[model samples]
Target: MRVSSYVIGAPLSDERFYLLLHGIRGTLDKVPARTGAFLVENRGKPLVSPPWDSDDRARAHLTERGYLTDLPEENERQLLVEVATALHDAALALRPPSFFFVPAYTCNLRCPYCFQPHEMHAGRGVYAKIMSHEQVDDAFRVIDHFDRPGALAEHLDLSQEGQGTADSGSVRRGALGLFGGEPLQEQTRDVIGHIARRAAERGATLRAVTNAVQLDLFTDLLGPDGLAELQITLDGMSDLHDRRRVGPRFRKTFQRIVDNIDLALARGARVMVRVNVDRSNADELARMNAFFLERGWGSHRAFSAEAAVVTGDAGRETLVTRPELVEVLDTIRADQESCLASYEGYAHGVLSRALSGRYPFTQVANCGAETGMLMFDPRGDVYSCWDEVGFAEHRVGTYHGGTLHLDHEAARAWLSRFPGAIDQCSRCPYALIHTSGCAKQARDNTGSLFAAACEGFQSYFPRTLATIYEQVESCLLGEAERPGPRPPTRTLPIVDVTHGRTRPPRDEVLR
Candidate 1:
């Protein structure tokens, strides 16, 4: 019997449940085998338990709950139409192309994991030139290409509506982000000013990512309203951090950063702290969260820290093993739950397991490159993401030499290769969700995207499941042993990975 959709009203009895189950199978038999596989494989079993004895048992449970149904064939067509409609709605919600402007390439410190290692060697004595006023105009020309076509149509619509001639869709300005060597550097103010002014004229919001050292200097560019969001980097607490991110005033630098953040917060400007997690600093992540909580910043805004498995030039063989990293993530999750109400324990746990090689399908699916967060270099060179920095072909465009362009089609084509690029991932059940894996890691380690994903899954999956089990067990123990007030949470400060590799010269050090 051909079925489309099923509807059930009122409370379900065992008898009704079984009837519905049989009907669903009858209808589903006509559906594709792949659909059957997906239902049976991915979302079939609860992670908390072993597999059910039989499909009958599963079906019975579903039917008893009144969740299972067999729909008429016509209803299936309607369901498809609804799904397509929802997809179209979602597509329309996404922001259109704005621009990420990188004004300089010089940074203050030599970070060990920084993709641009050459910049460190160049040292503080060398200043990377900021864009000239003429260059600023040229950059605007690029921005105009994206904004004007849509803006002109939008203007026409606004005029028509005002005059009662026509009704048109509302057009809101998009976002523009500033990048660096260190964008807050003294020299780049003009570049920032120019962009901020143009953004104001076009009704766009200006955002910036800075190290926060020279954030105060940009107050003029921020104007009375200030930036939409300012992202700052803080690796860890002072002692641990100063050891890694060594400079003339390491202690004062971080203190000033925190001070600046407090000032920004008081003024109604958004401040986000971006902590880059690596093997060395992974253990301290929970402590960092606790530190934030003490300062009252954890609850006021979004507090998040990301784990990045070192890749490209920085991904050495001796870094934290996949299993070790999973352990660190579990600790992070547990710590985060103390203060944050909406902690993603299970999801991140799953990701950790995938990263550790416990889950078969836990491969890298959506690298930032494919997800539209493209990286830009000091000279306007485009890369897929931060890690895949050196590839010649991936350079989609550049601003130098009077040629500035982006091949959107080419970019899409490159991203499309992420799935089915690796053999193990292609055959794995989770391939669709994860895609192939981290292309930069794959290329760096195994020299093949497929190999990298497969290896990562092998390492991440088992450990992740084990970690989850342990966490659950710990919770049970806590309930049984000392169930009073929970212990206070601690936030570990970020430790910069690039400081104190060598002693300062005699002349540079104070007696």
Candidate 2:
């Protein structure tokens, strides 16, 4: 018998109890001092002598919780593969089908740090071809192809259960997102309108990822009847944002985009302002938040702001780690007189789960790309990852000529990129949460899609977990001491394990 290699532990406030996370099992336990000591002594080692007697409850508990396993390392590795496979299957079964349309690869602005720069295309005319109405029709035909009776189950390799097939109408339709190059531009309004109508007819919601420079042109489609959501970027405040995301002739677009955001919000659109942060704009986040509050955007139910690390052409000198971004936000919050919440990065999800006393959701893969998402460009070529779009080598399939033709090898490569399938991630303690971090990034950094993209998951996990645990405990204790009758108990339903790791599936739990 041996302790599992995937257990992550953080000390609690009392020190007598420890918070231990069994990564593979997705179990979070408040272990007493005895069990904590046993874990510290035995983790990653085959037992030479038992830490406790055979009759000890601590031994039984650890074994039952998957902290101890009675298998060789290779056998245990196989078990991890099976666990990840089961989780992936569950995620596939529950996840809504996602589709993205890239009207063209050309953009209005030429941001120096643009991940998909036009110069990188080397004057390839493919970026200039706007998706025509004919291509839009073909796109819907492809959507119809997927919406056929058994197409969803067959395409995604999911088993049908009773009336869950695509023909049944019981399964809800998924998102249809408009993508680059600046999908919501004035030039493609007619095509965009046709696309929106088609999406509505198919019972799918319409959304867009745009810079919002020309969003005013699409105000008619901003409400509940039109786009369901908008992901707009604001690199920093006026001066910095203008410098970063400049239009042709270096046009000043700060105020125009801001006005368009207001128009979208007034029309009932959910606007998620993405502040792309690096050393260049990290200090500008708080001022941007202040602007949002002054504009009354912060209090709006449909508005939110988050700081995401800038990637791609931004050099190593400009980039900041996930924890550093969090710390920057915290410092800004401490200096502010306002009580509004700070911009949350990746840590928001962890903090939310901690407050609710629930285990964080385990990732089988990085994002929808590695799962079953399909993105189609103007040329009718399909890709798995958005970052890989417009590049032929990454093309997973094609929907040209009104027929779906899949490059089987490319498709298989993407579909099989889960943590269990990756060599380094298969044994890493943070595999379940990090999920081998960003396949595109892995290929870029290590020149292999299967390599681990660590990205500071190990460095930040312990401190973040411990700090959030203390905060939650303090908040709950305060609420418990309230003078009035306690609020009604909140019952959390057992969401599928892939969505959030509440419990393992009944048939698949390892003994």
Candidate 3:
């Protein structure tokens, strides 16, 4: 017998109890120090003797909980790959594909930290083109090809049991999204409305990720019956946000955006405000929430504000390490209502799922791109990832002249980019949670889509887990069994956000 390579545990405040999470099975429990120490000491090592001795109950617990397995390391790795692949296959068989249309790659704002080159937004480059009615119809043709009965079954090889048989009704209708260079601009308003109408005809929800500077121009189409959701960005208060998200000719945009948000909310549209935080704007988060409250935006059931760590091309000095960002969020949540300053932080999401007792399946890919997402740009180019848009070489296919052409080789690479296929990631304890991070990061950092792009998950996971574990301990254990007060939150040393161990130094952590 050997300790499972997927078992990871963090010692609780009591020191005598440890929180254990099985990476493969997603089972969580609190084990005594003896069990934790034994598992830790024997991890990845062969068990020459029965550590439990005659304690058959202890042995049974270890095996049944997936902490111990008799399979060799290579076999265990293969098992994980098989399990993850089967889960993905089943998911692909059941879910419809989601489409994102980038009307243009040109934006009105020149946010200093924007990742796209300034030339891309200059409206004179390859991105100068906008989606035309012909292109829109062509894109829908491609979508129709997928939505056709038995089309999904053609792609999925459901030869194995439990990998549900694909049928005409297997994959339901999907969603539509408007992406950028600024999808909601004055010039693109007509095309945006057309996209909404087509989405409505197909019964697909339409969403847009926009700066909201041009939102007023699209108010006629903003509501529950039109563009159902709008994801807007507000960096900070008016002064700080205006300075960061500068508009054309240095126009102030804070008030304009807030007014548009109000208009959208009043029109019955759901709005999600994304506050990108770095060292420069981290301290202003609470004040920003206060601003939202004063505007009465938070009072709307459909209105939400969340913090996101900024990793744009801003100066490294202005970027806060992942641990620092966590501390900032913890303080904000402590100071304000939980809903007032919430961040959909990766660690928090994983911990929530772990504690759910639902035995969530391990994540197969980093994001939807590897599953059912396809991004079609104005040039009729298709890409698996949004970050790869406008990069001609990264496109998975081209749809032009009402004909769809897919480079199966390129699409296959993205579909196969999962944790179990990466080298070090295949054995890492958190592989299932991080799922090898972002695939675009892998292509940029390692020059390959199949490689692991951890992006600080190692450092970020442990620190965030420790902090959140303390905050939610009461929910995990009975009052009589709960441990003492958690120790002070500790920050792990900063890890460069480039290599597999970290994120890109200048890109947002999309999750």
Candidate 4:
């Protein structure tokens, strides 16, 4: 017998309180200094009860708190297999899969760092066809197909006790995401409007991932309650944004986007302005935040600004990481004399589970890429995720004849990716929490289906935890930090992008 692979030790606020951070499978224990020492001393080692030969009350206390457990190798194996199967099943039984509809594959801006080129014709090897009404029909047909009676009752929280199926009244949430080339384009307004009206009728919310270039044109369609969130990207300031998001200079793209943002805000739609950053534009982000503050956009309840790391184009995004962006933000915050309490009134929400349990999702594996989520392109091709948006090889199915022709082999591979399924993650400290990173990114980078891609969970996550909790402690104590010496910044070391330590076997990877 050995210790269970589910325990993390960290201070909640300071050295006085140590968090015995067990995840959803177990409970969290806030122990004192002595109890924390006992747990840390015995962690990952064979457990011994109190008063066996030595009178170790701390060990008994920790065990009683559920931080200490016995796990045999055989039992662990069997448990993993069952949990993986349960997770896979839960995928099929969740709220209606998120529908990411691509109206067109042609973009108005020609960002040099853009990964997916604007495919105008077949010669480009990418589908650039504007989605026909038939494609729209096919998308709805697929969505309807997944909404079997009593299917999502167990997975999504909105479903009733015995009601498994989602109907027009119970669709509480079948998230509708509008993606590029540009969903708000003039030509695609009819298709976008159709989706919005359908979502509204079905009691679902529609969130648009748009360029915000022509959002004003569709203000009539973006009814106050219909459009939930507008995820628009702004590089930095006007000149920096114009240089990065290259478009017709005569068009006044910057001012137009700002005006469109105001239109969405006026309509009560949450405006999520993702400030795309790289080494070049990283420094400019603080200026953008200042600009928003100067314009009083900070006071708007639905307005938010966040630093989003650019992933697709490496040449365009040199030295881009979330920490680097945060450093620049911190530097600017000091310069601008903004405090944590000052930020509380500003309308922006960062997805953090430590602060609020509710954000994007609360699960071992948050994304629906493998199970319920599916995307449809202009060419009627079905994909498991948005990362594989423009890639043809990753197409899992095709939407022809208003029917989804799926590839079971490809679908099952993604479905198998969970905490228990991946052999490498069995030993990971935060396996149950982090789950797998981008599956496509892992496979593309490491040529393995089971390789762990991002190491932020192990690398920067602890530091980030301290940073957040420390601020919370400070804010709670009502201690306004007087500017003297700037606090030292700790950055994460880069992990190997090629592959994680273990590849597992092909059978396990494809299982």
Candidate 5:
């Protein structure tokens, strides 16, 4: 019998009693800190650890957690290859409930730190063209013909064991996600509405990622028949936001965005405010979160906030370490009125990630992108992932004549970019669950999709496991819900951190 090579033991940073077991993407287990010491004392290495001899309690615990298995060393890699192939096959067997269609690659604000290149954005003397109704019809027509997977049931089904749901197998096909340069721009309203109405007729969900500056112009589309939650951004207060998200196209967008946020909340529409933090506005993240708390938006059922470290070409200005980003979040969850603490960080976090579930890490395939999900960018091009949208070289196929014509070899290349292909991925301690973190990001940064793109998840993993433990503990202790109103906002002065904006050297404590 041999221990599985995929089982990883990550030491909890501040916890002396326990060590973390990242069994898979959706599973986390823990054993005593002494388990490591015991193994080290006995000179037993991972993947070849000691057996569950009766006298050892740690070994017994390990055995119960499937940490020990009866697999031969020589057959391990071969077994892993087969498991990965099964996972790849399963992901390709289905399509997400809704497709993320880019009506136009046009945005109102050309953010200075935009990850997208100049050619992807508008104002390049190119007109902002929204996807036509015919294009929308063609997209759905193609989607209807594809082999739809149960993946959409994870979020959109809204049904129980015996309950009935629409044939889209959804309370709505989940959502026909409206994404874009800016989906809410006045010119794109008609296109967005057409899609929303179609989704509503099918009892499917309708959602959008917008800038919110022109939200009021489309208030009629913010209710039951329209978007359930409009995802928008507010880098900081007016001065901070406008300076970074520069544009003559949208003046005073910061205040207007806030007003529209309030308007959306008042109308019973959930809002997701994405606050991208960098040295320019890191200091203001907690303050901005506090403002939301004071506005009572923090406690709203649909109000979800996400603080992502802004990543760019040069690593200098981006988040130096994941812990620094966590520090900002620590200040936020500290707010009594905010539920951010319970969530551990906004959408698709620990509890949510665990709940939404994930493939059991069979191989190197990373995210839904590598799967068969289809994204249609304007100009009738199709991509497996949105990040690859504007890059012509990554276009896996094209959408035309109400059908998808995908390059068989090119599409297979993505699925076959499995873990063993890259020694960097195959050799990682947590290669199983952290299979691949944005191959596109790695390709852009290091000129190879197979390059190690750890994204600092390993650095902050200890704390994440600890936080998940706390959440479970609190639940076990019968702690009543802790949502409460926060104190009113104080007259706090803002500190200037944007001088020169030349980022200091990144810390090496985290990768």
Candidate 6:
């Protein structure tokens, strides 16, 4: 199966892009004929079709015919030709990304859920020292090398057997992400400004994730006519958010963040709100949504809501079970439904599947790690996902001597850690749909993905399934009742980090 060039920009509109056969069954039946027919009729189309009803049928037919053929000459030859043609067409249609990591890992908040909290502490910084000007230059050099036509040519040559050409136009180049202990830190502002200026010089875009406390300072850097996107975190309403975020002045900090966000949006900068959901704040998330809607913030060009599973201490053993987390998620979803109908909201786990052809919210026995996004650290360590920050082997590369690049071998090694299948998950029908479980969490908790899936299946899967069952039952019984009054706003006890032990939960982390 192959995709057409027309599908490059508008993939959803051009259904032909879905034709790639990746071992899934009954895909052709689902593919729209208009797309398939368009490809077949287009004389210059590079795809080769076998004598079959659809691309899926053609693939199956080839595989069956090859398997049935007697000797190497007949079977291998035909199979090789078919595979080569499919790959060549795919290469032509493929669009590789140009991602960069701007050097800075400082963040202002010491939220319990963050994976990179080590970067913020005075002595034990998660990342090396703030990126020096030399380091910034090195980052630019690496990006420039990738942007060069020769680099693209080499990438294509290494990727496919001279089947396609990579041009400057075909490569999507943009600003590296603004990451830091706190990107807006006084020390890192210059680095952020330097990156913005450099991006303008090179005609690239600026994209960064921040807590938004210092966003006001960076507005000039965004400017007009520059590509920009900022992801800011606001876990819940002021009371609840302040409890979890634990800043010196919670109310003032949040207000400043909101003000900066408004300023950025007023200036045409794209902004996305990333709410890290945990047991404590899940109930308040809906209130937060209401907060956004009431302010008319939902209508902005770059406005959207993203929910992510909390990692680190938030994902610890005693905090809450998977079932409880799912329950929180359900409540959050129901509350936001009204707002979502009028605006855009995304759950991280479901969004990935929704964006891809993969099923959202369904269980999967196993899936490839390549199906997920890779988190690149400033020092060049590549993680399977953002949550696996502390694991050593998951580190894919480093930028010491020269540019460290990830290869197929490295990818395979990383993928090998996650068990593809196990009896418990395989027997469970949701396995293929949900894609097993999070590999990083599994490895950290159980030392293997399969074990993680199994444990998750036993511990959390039942709750998730039960929740669905309850929801379905509720629909049968009529509209489900809304959850009770918002839990008394409790202040979290500030753990003395100097002593390294958590204090008992309090009404507020701050006084």
Note each model's CA RMSD in angstroms.
12.2, 7.0, 5.7, 7.8, 8.3, 13.5
lDDT on C-alpha atoms for all candidate structures:
0.44, 0.66, 0.68, 0.57, 0.57, 0.45
For model 4, the stretches where C-alpha displacement exceeds 4 angstroms are 1-4, 11-18, 23-26, 29-55, 72-88, 118-126, 148-173, 200-205, 248-252, 323-361, 471-511
TM-score versus the correct structure, for each prediction: 0.61, 0.83, 0.85, 0.77, 0.77, 0.59
Give the Cα error of residue 62 in candidate 1, in Å: 8.0
In model 5, the Cα lDDT at residue 410 comes to 66
Could you give candidate 2's per-residue lDDT for residues 31-97 as a string of tens digits?
Answer: 7756665675567788656646565687888889878888777777777787787666555554444
lDDT of 5 by residue, 1-511 (tens): 4455545454544455554453332344555565643432332234443433544676666556555555553355555555554554444333333366778887777777765655556735432456898888888777665525533232322223443323453232565666666667877788887877776776665667677888998888776456766767788877888887666577567888899998888877767676666777888776777787788887676676655565645346555344577755656565534533211221113334444464434334555455445677767888765556666788878898798877766665554555555666654545555555666666767987667667676656555556555555555678754232222121110111111111100110000
- TM-score rank order: 3, 2, 5, 4, 1, 6
How would you encode candidate 1's per-residue C-alpha lDDT over 1-511 as one tens digit per residue?
A: 2111221111112122111111111111111233223333333233223233355666565444323434444454344334333322222222223356667666655555566554432433333455566665666665554342123222212112222212124433555666655667666776677778777887776666677777777765543244666666666776555555544334446677778777666665666565555667666567766777788886664333333334334566535544455566556554454332111222333433443445322223244343233344554566544433334466655554433555655454434344444444433433433345445545556754435344344345433433333344456668433211122121211111211111000010100
lDDT for 90 in candidate 5 is 45
lDDT of 6 by residue, 132-195 (tens): 6665666666566555323422443434455454665544454445544456655677766777
Q: What are the per-residue Cα lDDT tens digits for candidate 4 across 1-511? A: 3445555665554677665554324344566755555555565667655223264675665556446666664565556445544544554454445567888776666665665654541214455477777778778876766654333222333233443454544443544777766677777878877777777776676777677887888887664467677767677778877776765432447877888888888887877565656778877766787777777676666665555456543563274654454456657765774311111110111213434554322344425565555678888788775556667788877887777777767765666566666776665555555556657667777887677755345544443444444565576678965331122110111111111011111111100
Q: What value does the lDDT take at residue 10 in candidate 2?
A: 72
lDDT minimum window of 10 residues, candidate 2: 492-501
lDDT of 6: 0.45
The best candidate in terms of lDDT: 3
